[model samples]
Target: MPTDASNFSVTMVIRSILYTTQQASESPYNYVPTEWVCIFFLTAYSISTAIHMGQALRYKLWWMIPTVTFAGILEIFGWSCRLWSSQSPELLRPFEMQLFGTILAPTPLVAAYFIIFGRITIHFGPQFSRLTPNMYIIVFFSLDTICLTIQAVGSVFAAEAVNEYKSPTLGGNIMLGGISAQLFAIWVYLGLAAEFFLRRKYNAPFRRQVIKFGKGQRSMSKDVQCMIYALGFCTICIIIRSVYRTVELADGWSGTVISTESYFNWLDGGFVVVAMYTLNVIHPGIYLKSVDTSLPDEDKVNLSYVF
Candidate 1:
């Protein structure tokens, strides 16, 4: 491996050469991520998506297909781009592709997590919830959409940035803002979920009725139990991912932590991948049976990728 200075100087020379030749300008720096790590995540997320697809189709989970499908696609494709950059570090295209794709990939996955809460609440009877089950899907997901769009737009701007020549601060700040918004949204959603569970656990309205209704869940079924566990685990996993993004982005786009591939794989990629697989194994679609199609249109996917 060449020294950092040599690597940078070579990149500068290449950029200058491209400029003189009137060729498309490229980023002067190459990330050069480890190939094995990229392959590992790509393969894992792909298999997870395939399994989730089978389960979704088996249970007719139309609402979840968009969220699950897009996340898997984005993660797999983003990692593939990383593989490209590792092989040919001088090319700028792969870096641009991975930048926004990987960052925006988890947005839909987090939406899936938010949807699970609403469904679980409905299963247990929304009356025990501090807010209606509908509220969870409507409010939190709207916030999710905002966060997703902001981050995506910010990434686009960042990708257009010329390394060592242009400032990425504007785009970086927008991305950071989106991440901040997501952190707030998920934390609030978690608080609501915790409140609902506690309210049901303690002496609250419908406490006695809810207990007698299902004989403490014998009537509600095992799927309900599974949904509870799945939701809890998924929340924790995604929270770790969001926190990682927030901290990593705060350090600036080219900060040491963000520049380190291993750390990112462990925190961002690892956290979301575990959550996706865990959700697949404990699939709510397997147990949810049938949701009311008559429920507000916003709750269903209906071709909306972000919601």
Candidate 2:
């Protein structure tokens, strides 16, 4: 039989081997993230952020400046972390930073969209909207705040669990709840958007109101129309991204959705890239003018007034 000291040494060697094996087996990203892909995203976000800052400054789009800039910066940071993670896939810090940064980045961007839609409603006429222009911002932004909080807290727990080399089921579930709530809010917002458009198209009195920068009764300016179309496209892309994230988290950390990097590259990263660039091409600052504040609000129908 081995002496006690030798036995202890043997046991320590076995434990060391097992610990290394566990570390090797537990990758935050099941597959190593592609380096080139991460670089592409990082570069793209950096350029877009520069463009957004210039536009916001030029047009004095004070409301959009912070939200869009913040989103772009977060995206840049996240992608940079991803690039670092690709190099050091075994490291926990990069994974934690990328995961938290990417997940939370879009929240501000989505808030910017809400504000855009609210401004659009005001531009067309708030009376045509079901919940009024301001209510759209109020209701959706409040829900967004709640969801953001949930997601932030959940991400911390998930990161801790990952550090401890345990299953992130509880944290994942919490994140799912938050993301699911966000999805529901997006759907409802779409419904309200539909209602606003339908009301504007079919409502007789509003149709007769003098159209802005257009000759015909129902015609909107080409710029406004383009802005509206761009907003719609962005909304669709965001929906796709949100759905992808929701499903990814729902399938647990070790599941197929998270295991495959392609789904994330396309559904999550691709969609957002498309959306951000689409906005850059058809920028709201250039296409969408300020709401005509001179117009009377006597006919406005707010949710507060209804209740």
Candidate 3:
């Protein structure tokens, strides 16, 4: 019905339109999809940590269980909030989740450290160590409580002033500082605990002779090794998170750091969740009970060796 030239021109117009539309669809902004893989892994890790911590509680490892549970719950909420963010990047609700989650998660870690040292004193005679066990608990945990309180207050203030003063920056800094302090304390405490344990192990001839008689006594060494490894991993993870947060916050509210929420999700959610779940695997419920019974009452009460 139409001339050949007319038909050819019409076909060319249609093809051009289609090609333009396809190009727009393939633009970088449109093609860059959110990372759902990270979300799934974080979710799985958090759930598993929570379940394992719940099981740990049944064994009456009260100090260890509560801290692990608290950390796991915060992580679950954080990851869930992250999922919501991935679905609707414009809503901005997940910022609260990230804010509160990071602030609340580390409190339980500090508390766990306190419990470990406290229990150690109870197991080993407090007199065996240069410092009293109760003093160590009071000093370190008191500092930790103060740090947590400050960080919590900062978070609340930051949340109220969201996007105004970049409150999360200040709050996150306080939290990072608190966690850094906690990590430092852990290292110090670990050194002190280890020194005490080794001193007692080699110096106490009577106990050494007694422990050699029973094959089960080797379990004590294994338990101590497990605890050291778990605590070490926890410290490293917290330090990593703290460093990441500190750098992210250094640029303030207007920086690309806060705007790029996805980056935060990976560092905060991915690394922290994995580290926490690892700690669950070595929970005191499994190791402590098996080895604790082997120690004499005096050894058990020695606070230096308990953790």
Candidate 4:
């Protein structure tokens, strides 16, 4: 409900705005009435994202929530921009908003998961990892950051092309490069995670150490498993979204997939929204409360997670 006269007037102004463009230069063709859908996504994502932040503060899952929260907030902003695009497609601002915001949004989620993986390996025993636990954050996250910058700058270039009324192939290629790089990083991370999990599950070395130390140590705690599940679930969701974006961008701005609003909702918006909500419901803080103290005192990679 609109609160005041000014609000009502602004609403009317937005509704009245419409974009007119020729076929050759027009990038995003309006496929559906995106105004309401964008708003719905924005609202849902905000609640879940905010809840994650609140959960972190309440339960002291400090390292976990920041990146997810940031990602969620960014998605909300991106969708709001989508609404702006719905109202005025000819305007560069709205396209720019959704383009850059959505592209950069998941990078933080990647960071969150990358950080959690290090912590997870540390808790499980860093010796199980092929690369040191420290490298998890330093290597993968550095890639994520670099990939994010490339994607962001590329999106900016693509969005800004509306000013000249000419599409730029270079911008699209840069964005694709960024997306492909990020996807490559994710695949590498997944490979590392899989190898470590397999080694811990079956390898004779880690098994002998566990046996030498204690039998019960072989079975991970229920909470620890939940933490793994949450991280894995979120990561899979990011991977799904990244894959969709990669394919969509391959068609370039004028491609059928990029122009399709339903695809955006189903793939881009759906994946992240589901992930944030899923993680919120799973609640990492609940699973990881006692995890920090459980690390081996000698090789313990110290991470400040206040319980």
Clashing pairs in 4: none
What CA root-mean-square deviation does each model show from the true structure?
A: 8.5, 8.3, 7.7, 7.8
Q: How well is each residue in 1-307 modelled by candidate 1, as lDDT tens digits?
A: 7999999999999998776334212322324567788888889988998988888788877767788767878888888887787666667678778877888888888888878778777656465676666778888888989999999999888778734347777887889999899988888887878887777767464322322322243134666677778778878887788788888878876677776667788988898899889878788776565334323454343311111
Per-residue lDDT, model 3, residue 3, is 98
Model 4: per-residue Cα lDDT over 53-91, one tens digit each:
888799877775658888888898898887877666656
Clashes of each: 0, 0, 12, 0
lDDT of 3 by residue, 12-74 (tens): 999998865564344211212244754675667667766666766678776555676777777
Show model 2 residue runs off by greater than 4 Å.
1-26, 204-219, 290-307
The numbered model that scores best in lDDT is 2
TM-score of each: 0.79, 0.83, 0.69, 0.83
List, residue by residue over 97-209, the lDDT tens digit for candidate 2: 88887887777778888888897876565556777668778999889889888888888888888889887788888888888888888889989888888877886322223
Question: For each candidate, what is the lDDT?
Answer: 0.74, 0.79, 0.60, 0.77
Cα lDDT of candidate 3 equals 0.60
Candidate 4 residue-wise lDDT at 132: 70
- Candidate 3 TM-score over all chains jointly: 0.69
The runs of at least 3 residues in candidate 3 whose Cα sits more than 4 Å from the true structure, single-residue gaps closed, are 1-38, 117-130, 163-180, 190-220, 256-266, 297-307
